[model samples]
Target chain A: MNLYELTIGEAHGLLSRKEISAVELTRAVLARITEKDEKIGAYITVTEASALKQAALADERIAGGDMTPLTGIPLAIKDLICTKDIKTTCASAILENFIPPYDAAVMEKLNRAGAVLLGKANMDEFAMGSSTENSGFKITRNPWDPGRVPGGSSGGSAAAVAADLCLGSLGSDTGGSIRQPASHCGVVGMKPTYGRVSRFGLVAFASSLDQIGPLTKTVSDCALMMNAISGYDNRDSTSVPREVPDYTQSLTQGLKEVTIGIPRQYFETDGLDPSVFLAVQKAVKTLQDRGATLVDVSLPHTSYAVAVYYIVAPAEASSNLARYDGVKYGARDKTQSSLLGMYRQTRSKGFGKEVQRRIILGTYALSSGYYEAYYNKASQVRTLIMEDFNTAFKTCDVLLSPVTPSPAFKFGEKREDPLALYLSDIYTISANLAGIPGMSVPCGFSQEGLPVGLQILGPHFNETMLLKVAYNFEQATDFHKAKPVF
Target chain B: MKITREEVIHVARLARLELDETDIETFSHQIGTILEYFDTLNQVDTQGVKPTSHAIFLTNAFREDEIKPHLDREKAMANAPEKENGYFLVPRVIG
Candidate 1:
């Protein structure tokens, strides 16, 4: 197989054996991007010079006997994440040319791991939309269906992995940004337990809900990457104090008596796609046949997830984006003669329509007249949703569901219709609201031949247990083996 | 749940956006639909429960007012759209 197609596991084995140098692997990935990325639209900026320079250093270290699982591996970072010296755009015109002076905690973590960063991939502007259509840049298409959206926010990272443009990618999930794209692109996306990973360098969409996680070709790869980037970071006050575990160690152990819960509440008359339903059913059977107990559970307050998320996320966004005034940071369209004109002109030109819309709604929700009514009420609903998960997890180790109501839709299908777009993330957003870890793994394909994802969600920091079950299930199934024919 | 043009305009003002009449109606319809969909939250009962904002249980995470190593002035001003004499430049308000 080409280096681009090699799983992180295979590439690591080859690297350790001196079969492939990091520079060689990096060149192969860059070459593949040149050949294939035009159709995928997976990247906004490819830092070929910096990437090659990093790859060269990786080879030098490996030659001197220093190695990590990610050493020399080519990676695509979602543009919403900050990277030192690299233009850190939240896929918005405001930060179009803004470069951070410091690396994000994950960036520092990954660099120490010796990973070669390919460059920044595109996303929904300010992580605002359910589809990548909200990005100030061009649309990122699904590798599986060129005409369809690559789901979104983390859509570029997911597209990169699906198209084999990068070995793995880093994506931020404020709501369903990571998981939804992973579901649509037929890759693995892990939205870590909210505090599980630090948010020091991530561009905030929803302060409480935003998390940085890895998107990879397989669950095992995602787990490995998560291990590298997760753990305590003093720079991020929200970073958890829990001890980070080596996720790969327990992953191969088969699920013998683990209880995998099926939330029956998520399936009641919500107009879910029949294909996604079938795929999730098959996955449940696969888990059950592999000796895991199948438990029927209820997250009865689940339908409130989207409602809680939209209000809370926007409210947070409204505050976070206030830093982008023309006076201080980022780009400003300032031919305005007056100070107010400058602020108005700059912001109006900077943020995309979707981002502006959210900011407006959030500003009002948090305003004096309505703060208690809308934002506060939404927070209460959020509590109920998390409590539902808490109650469900008491009965079982993890919950299983479809990552999305349907697979990827046509590029323009949900662009004009915002509600239809929001509905696409119904199954995945709840985990974000609750601050839990969720994974979207390829399970099956629709009759239309597009891929579907079976979501596995677990309680906070139960990622090791979740990965064990996911890997065991993956080993028993061959769904992840399928690759797109571009 | 039914957000109006006035509501959109009011929110827009809070957000410091310069939207005209056309944008107000469009945003109202779009935001209205989204809010209506979220009205599903009204069905749930969140009685006497602590409003859970953060997923992981942690509190009092605010840091003390410590003067840490801030970025250099040149570094800070590197990305400023408009800068003047090591400061972020804006139209001077006071004469």
Candidate 2:
């Protein structure tokens, strides 16, 4: 097998046995990027020079017998995560030249674990869009079908993994960003419960909803990545003070006695592609036949999730994004002589259309007269949505649904219609709204050959249940074994 | 819920964004449609429910008041669009 195609677990075994060095693995990945990235457009920055240097250091660590599971593993980072010396452009022109001086807490942990940095992956500008076509630089194409989007704002991370540019990647999920892309790319994506992973380095979109997780070639690799990143940090105030188990230890063969709930509302979602629905139904039956019990559950407030998310996310985004006033950081409009003019010009020129739209929506929602009518009302509905999930978890250990309503759609298919694009996230958005853990594992492919994702959702901080069920599902299916021929 | 061109311009001003006439017209239509869709939130009865700002309830997370090394001025101003010897340069706020 190609070194570039090895999962984290596979590569770690080889590295620890001295069968291959980190430099060889790093070079193999860099070569793959140099060979194929022009067609994929999965990276904003490749970090070739620094990646080799880090890989050399990882080899030294392995020689000294001080290695972690991620030691010497080359991985791509979603551009939103801050890296000390690398240019972390959140795929926005505003921060095109912005270089962060400090490393995010997650980056610090990865560095300590001796992981090699491949580069910064592309994302939606400021992570406000569902398709990476919103990226200011370039659109990330699905490796499965180059004409379709890989999904965003973590589209690049998923594409890189699917195309074997990197072994595994780190992606942040605000509203189904990671899982959607991983689904589109035929990879495993896990979004841990809010606060389970530190948010210190992740650039904020909606502070209350954002969580950083992993996109990998397999569920076990996802667990290994989680073990390294899931812990408390003083930097993030919301970082939970809980014991992070060795996530890999939860990987077992069977799902005996596991109750997988099928959310009736999710199955009855409007505009759901018939193929996706059929695929998820088959996935549920497969789990049931493999010793799991299926239960019918209902999250009655599912209809209100999209409405609540749009308002609440934008409101928090407006406040979180206010920091980019062309003064403290980011580019400035030199032609404007007045302060307010500079602020206005810099922002208008810096942010993209979707970003501008959300900022305006957020500003209008938080405006003096409309706060109670829009933002406050949305917040109240958000509480009800959380209650619905809490109630459903009582009857089932995890809920099963389709990650996206359809397989990967072709470029420009839904880009023009904003409402149509928002509805694509109908099944996955509720997990984010409720601050629970959710994941996507490849189940089947469409008639057109695009991958379908089966979503597994667990209650807050119950990633173990989600991972166990996903691991069992992955072991039973060969869907994840199928790679996109690049 | 109807976002007019004037309202779009007004909200842009509040958000400190400069917009052209075409952008104003387009945003007026787009924002109006999205908010029209958002009208579904009004259907839910939230009379007695408390607004949740965060998914998980958290209080003031305090830490010991201790001295920690701060970022050096050079690194802090590394990405500033305009920078002086050791500070970020901004438009004059004082007359």
Candidate 3:
């Protein structure tokens, strides 16, 4: 296999044996990015100079007998995560030239692990849209098919991993941003339970819902990343104070005692593609053959997840995004004289169409006289959605479903219809609403050869259970090994 | 559930975003559809259901009241669009 194609585990083994240098691995990945990123549009910025420097430092660390699993592993970061001195644009023109003065909590951890930063991946502007098409920057194409989207708002990270542009990547999931794209790109992506990771220095899109996780070529790599990034920090008050267990320890083989819940509502969901249903059904049978029991469960309020998510996520986004008022960091409109005029102009010109649309929707929902009917109602229904999961988890260890209704759709297929794009996340959005962990593992491919991902969800802070099932399935199936022939 | 152009413009103003005539028309129609979809939530019986502003319930996270190092003035002002004497300079607000 090529150097760029090695998983984090494989590359670490090689680096630890002193067979290949960190600089060699970083250079190979950077060369792959330079060769393929133009066609893929997976990166917003490529940090070649800093990446090599970090790799050299990692080499020194490895030579001095101080190396972690991620030492010298090159990874892409979703553009929303703040990297000090690097231009961390959330794929928006508002912060196009903006540079952060401090690293995000995840970046600080990854840096301490001696990981090499390849670049910042692209995403939807402010992470508002389902497809990367909403990005103010370039569009990221699916590695499987260049005409289709790579999914968003973590499209770039997913695409980079799929195309061997990077070994693994960091992606933030608010409403299926990580899992949906990982499904589309045929990779493994996990969104830890809310508060499992610190949000400090992460460019906030929807503060209450957003959580950063990993997208990797393999489930073990995902676990490696989870081990490195999951922890509590005083800087982010929302960071949970609970102890993080060693996630890799849960990667056992058999699922003998595991009970997977099949949500009846998800199978009966409207617009679920037959191919996706068949693939997930086959995966269910495969787990059963591996000595796991399947139980029929019902998350009755699953249908309302999209509606609740649209209202709640956008409402939080409107409030969190109020910080960009032409005063501090990011773009400003100098042509306007008055403060209000400048604020209006800077925002009007800085934000893209979808972002502006969300801001308007969120403001209208939270407006006086309408709050009770819109925002409050949505939050109450959100409670029902969470309760649905809590009730279902009582009968099973994890819930299984298709990650998306179908595989990656062609660009512009759903771009014109915002409601359609919102509905695409019907399966994965509930995890974010309920603050539970969800993962997308490559299951099979459609007849058209597009990838299909099997989504596994577990209770809050139960990421270990989800990872075990995913790891077992991955070891049993070769779907993850099937790479997109670009 | 249908939002009119007037309401769209009103929300835009509240959001501190200036919308053009075309944008107002587009958003009016689009937001109306989304709001109509949101009307589905009313079907659920949530009479006394409490709202969940956050997924996890955690009390206020408090730290000891002590002076610790924070972002210095220069670093804080590094990304400011307009700065004067280590302060973010905005347009005149007291006029």
Candidate 4:
């Protein structure tokens, strides 16, 4: 197989068997990035020297007979993650030149696993929008259609995987940042339960809801990467302590008696595209044929999820992002001679329009006059949203829905209307609010040729169930076999 | 849905953003259009229903109150737009 198209498992087997060298594999992917990134805009920073150095070390480890799950594999990390001594820009102007002195927990884990770092992928400025157009550095185009954007925040990582620049990538999801992009790029993206992965050293956008996850071309590959990265870290107080199981071992489990819940309200909404509905409906048929019993379930608080999310996320972001006050590790406008001028100039010039809007709205909601009516109330409503999911899970093993309302749209399609862009995450936001695990896998395609995704959501810490059901559905359909055209 | 000039100015100030006349004119209309759509929140029956904020069950996680090592003041102030001695300097407080 061509180096660019190699799977993580394939690369490991070849490396251990001495059929391929780590330097060659890393060089091959670097060459692919140099050739294709101009058109796709997948990476903001390509670490050629560091990647080669890591590859050499990986080769040394193999020569010494020491191998790990990520040994000798090239992986792309979303820019939202911090890497010590490496420039981490979150695709925003504010931290344009910032170089972190500490490594994010996953970066440290991946390094210990001996993974070769390929590059830092682009993302929306602070992961604010659904479309990659919000990435101030560059826009990531879908490999399927250059005119359309790959979904945002993790868009660059998704595009990179779709274009075969890397075998796997780590992306942070606030509201479908990982899943939405994976759907657009025709890959498998998994968002583990809220605390499944550590957030230490992550460039915080929304503290309570943000999570790190894996995006890969297949379910097994995602599980493989997850095994290496998911675990408790002392640096991040929220990292869960549940035992990390062998997810790959569970992939072959058939769905003979598995009960899958179909949330009827998800696809019946007015905004859903007709083609997406047909695609998900077709996907459901395959699961039902696999001997999995289908049951209808209701998450009555679905409508309130987005409302609660907006208030809660912005409130968290407003506080989390306050750390970049130009007095610390980011850009500073030297011309501002006064204290207040420094604050205004640094922020006004550093942050983007959407970020400013959120900070403003969030600050207002948290203000004394509005606290009880907004922030406090949103917290109470958030409980109802979680309870809604908890109640649904008692009746079925997992819940399934469409990953997005529609396929990728044109560059300017929803840029003018921010609300329309936020609505794009309607189906996925509740998962974040409830802190459950959700995965998006290719289900079918729209007639216009864009890939459609089916989302399988499971209760907190029940990622194994989500992946197993997705793996079974994948085995039954050729949807994932569809490749993007360059 | 109609946002007044005063509200626009107030939000901009709260956001710590500097807005030109064009920005004010555009935002007043744009934000109004978006906020009107938020009427969807009101449409959902929330009466007597407790509002939710956090999703996870964990709460009030506390750490020891002992002072922790923070970034050095010199290093932290090095990136400031303007700094005077050990302090981050900005505009005069007098508004």
Stretches of candidate 1 exceeding 4 Å from the true structure: B62-69
Error of 4 at A280 (Å): 0.9
Give residue A246's error in model 4 in angstroms.
Answer: 1.6
Tens-digit lDDT track of model 2 for A231-345: 9888899999889998888789478879989999998888889999999999998899889998999899999899899998999999898888898788788888889999999
Which one wins on lDDT?
3
Fnat, model by model in order, equals 0.84, 0.82, 0.91, 0.52
RMSD to the true structure for each prediction, in A, is: 1.5, 0.9, 0.9, 2.3
Lowest summed lDDT across 10 adjacent residues in model 3 chain A is found at A414-423
Docking class of 1: medium
Stretch of 10 with least lDDT, candidate 4 chain A: A334-343
Winner on DockQ (2 vs 4): 2
How large is the interface RMSD of candidate 1? 1.5
Off by over 4 Å in 4: B44-51, B59-95
List ranges where model 2 is wrong by over 4 Å. none
**lDDT minimum window of 10 residues, candidate 3 chain B:** B1-10
TM-score, predicted candidate 1 vs. hidden true structure: 0.97
Residue B88, model 1, lDDT: 72
Given the true complex, what DockQ would model 3 score? 0.87
